[model samples]
Target: MGINAHFELGLGGFSLDAGFSAPGRGVTALFGRSGSGKSTLLRCIAGLERAPVGRLEVNGEVWQESGRGRFLPTHRRPIGYVFQEPGLFPHLSVQRNLEFGWKRIDRSRRRVAMDQAVELLGLGRLLGRAPGGLSGGERQRVAIARALLSSPELLLMDEPLAALDLASKAEILPYLERLHGELAIPVLYVSHAPDEVARLADHVVLLQEGRVIHQGGLNEALTRLDLPLARDPEAAAVVEVRVAEHDERYQLTYLDFPGGRFTISRRALTPGQRLRLRIHAQDVSVTLNRPGETSILNVFPARLREMAELNGSKLLLRLEVGDAILLARITRKSADHLGLRPGQPLFAQTKALALLN
Candidate 1:
């Protein structure tokens, strides 16, 4: 039971034709630039923008089907929608704002408890505060709690962080991560920021000009050199690792993945704690033979799985290390000099990696 949607709409000079299906769990991000129809697609699924020809199903429930003449009105749909701004009642206290939706659902229909919502968003401290007195991040947290109190089967977030500045976005991101970790409902998040998608999304739907260019797991979708995302200089591969050990003297933490162990600045993580790492392709270098006595601490033997020309001067190689995949971007000259080919074993070294949640 997952989401399946197809929508085609023509308004003025813009036309949108897009369809995609994603697992009904985890965070599925609708990623694209402005005017790319991310919001329009969400609206179509929510019944706010009725496309003459469209179909939508969420968690095995049919929300719309134009061909069958079945359509659920916006209010009838079981969804929690969060907009760019926290649209809380300015006059209402945070507790009452959260209860606004909670009080509307029938007791027999309630799936989410009031205390659960409050705890999940850490609203205990702000419950008595007015919306106007809360910070941007705090207000958004209240907004999300309000949405959750409705007991929705699905959550739709339309650039929830877009209106917040850098610091506010940072402040809210951990709360969003906690929500992703604790909630069971499927979340459809819309955003143009690549970092947000990389950090929060488990699956991705890449939209452009009102069409889906690609859709798949976050790691696979972001590492394809052919896509605009991978073409960026900051494009990277994401991997999950567990805390292996920590060196008190060096102030470093060791994380173990299928490929190998990664050494990074120390974090407040206990042993065996799972962490996500982003390894930039630019930070990786390819070598035919293993290097010794080098400053780079992360190196592993990898088999070249595939190669693609990224541009006139650069090439992208997809390598398999143990059970994990790593992407390396190297110059065409280096590739030619090394005579790189599929099935060949080589050493890959990384000078930088970032921990993402």
Candidate 2:
């Protein structure tokens, strides 16, 4: 089951014509540059913007259908919205603010328990604290908890960490990760930050000029040479791996995936623990034949999937390493020197990769 949405709206000079169906369980990130209508499309899904032609359905429940004269108001939609700011009530205590949403639900309709919400968000200690006394990250955590208490079917977060400083963003991201792993309710996250999308999104809806340019699972969409992400300086591909073993002498931990295995700086990780890591395109270099000896520890046999011109100076290669796809950005000179071609056997030497914290 999934959420289906299509919206067409015109606000003055700008127009929005976007539609996409996203998974009903995990987080689906709406990713785009600023002014790309990420927020406008979200508002349309929330029924906050009455698009002239719109249709929204969540797991078979119809929220709005413009052609049938059916439109559920924002308040009636089973949604929880978290904006840039925490938006906690100024006069209320943290406990009361959470209860504001909880108390509104009748006993029979309460799917999320109050205690569970508090625990999931780590809000027990700060219940009595007023919103003003809490830090920016704390307030956001409270806002998320309050939203869950509403028993929403869909959670909408719009740049939830944009207002926070680096420290605050660091503080809140783990909690968000917990939500992504533990919660059953679906989430639609809106953010322009690539790091945020890379760390949290299981799926992506790429928007450009108010249109959905692409939509698919995170890895496929992120590494698509045609997408803008592949051309960015920070362009990278996210790969999920399981901890294989640890090398105590060398202080390294091995991670395994279908693409093969490699070791990283040892962490206090247990065998079989699963995590996602980013492999930056710039960190990858391709060779026509396997190298005899190298300082690089992560080198795997790969086949050239495709290539695209990144710019006049650089070229982007999509390499298939076993079952996984990895991106490599190399100088046009290096590509020409290697005579790269599709389906050519090659070795991808990766210099760096980092686990999503």
Candidate 3:
């Protein structure tokens, strides 16, 4: 399924003029920093905010058409939205809060079972509890379950983890991934976190000043040297890998990427398990010669393809490894010291980067 929209709206002193389409499956992250109009664009799609000259179509269904005078009401749209806050009713129990949407529909149209939603979100234990009694993460889980139970054809999550702390964010991330992997519904996830985007998104839509700057697969858009986010100190290339083996002696899990194997800090990762690894640009170094003695376990031969200035003194390099590309950021001094240039053969060392599985 795909979503296409062209919106022109004025809110407060700023005006929004933007358009983009989301991928059918996996998370299509609306990525940008603050004041980029990401939230406003989401609201337009959700039918909460309307534009006089706007058009929106999801999964081949036209929710809005400016010229045709067609517009679908928010309640009538087959969409589920989870905002930054859980927004649960304090007086209602978690179970009752989840069931609020159920009463709006006829019994025959409700396809989502309460038991399935509870199990999917691990909300069975919290059913009897009030919203005030639950933690931030628990409340978010309940919110997700409630949204799922609404039987939406498309799910729109606008910074769902933004209100939580680091630990709380970590707690809810796995459940989000599970929902994506197991469910048939497509998700449009909005966030500024590149790490989260890299971890969860199969496709991406990068917006800036209410305009679409980039839209494609996450790897292609993220690895591009032109985008501002690619110049971040924490900029990294995300690779989907599979578990190859486990070393009992070292207590390490071996994962296979396109070029070679990588040993990461994971355990009980059975063979054939799919995983993602974020190889940060700063953590990667290019070596002209292979070192004999080193603690680094990952060193793959790659050819330098492109180089761009991260700043005046620092440079970012794009290296090719089979069909996949890896990013490395280094100083101009180091580049000149190592005589690095495009088409030069180099060994990339990256063993300290975080591995999320």
lDDT of each model, Cα atoms only? 0.91, 0.93, 0.87
Instruction: Output the number of the TM-score-best candidate.
Output: 2
Cα lDDT of model 3 by residue, 1-357, tens digit: 677888999988778898987776678889998888889988999999989889998889999998999999998998889988999989999989999986665778776778888888888889999999889999999999888888888899999999999999898888888887888788888999898998889888888888888888988877899986678778889888889998888888888888888887657777999988888888889899887899998888899999998778999999987667899989999999999989999998885767764
Q: Better model by lDDT, 1 or 2?
A: 2
lDDT of 1: 0.91
TM of each candidate vs. truth? 0.96, 0.98, 0.96
Q: What is the lDDT of residue 274 in candidate 1?
A: 83
True-vs-predicted CA distance for residue 339, candidate 3, Å: 2.0
Show where candidate 3 strays beyond 4 Å: none
lDDT of 1 at 229: 81
How many backbone collisions does model 1 have? Answer: 0
Better of 2 and 3 by TM-score: 2
- By lDDT, the better pick of 1 and 3 is 1
| Residue-by-residue lDDT tens digits, candidate 1, 59-171 | 88898999999999999999999999999999999999989999999999888899998898888999999999998989999999999999999999999999998999989
The CA-based lDDT of model 2 is what? 0.93
Please list all clashing residue pairs in model 1, or write none if there are none: none
Candidate that would win on lDDT: 2
Off by over 4 Å in 1: none
Q: Supply the global lDDT for candidate 3.
A: 0.87
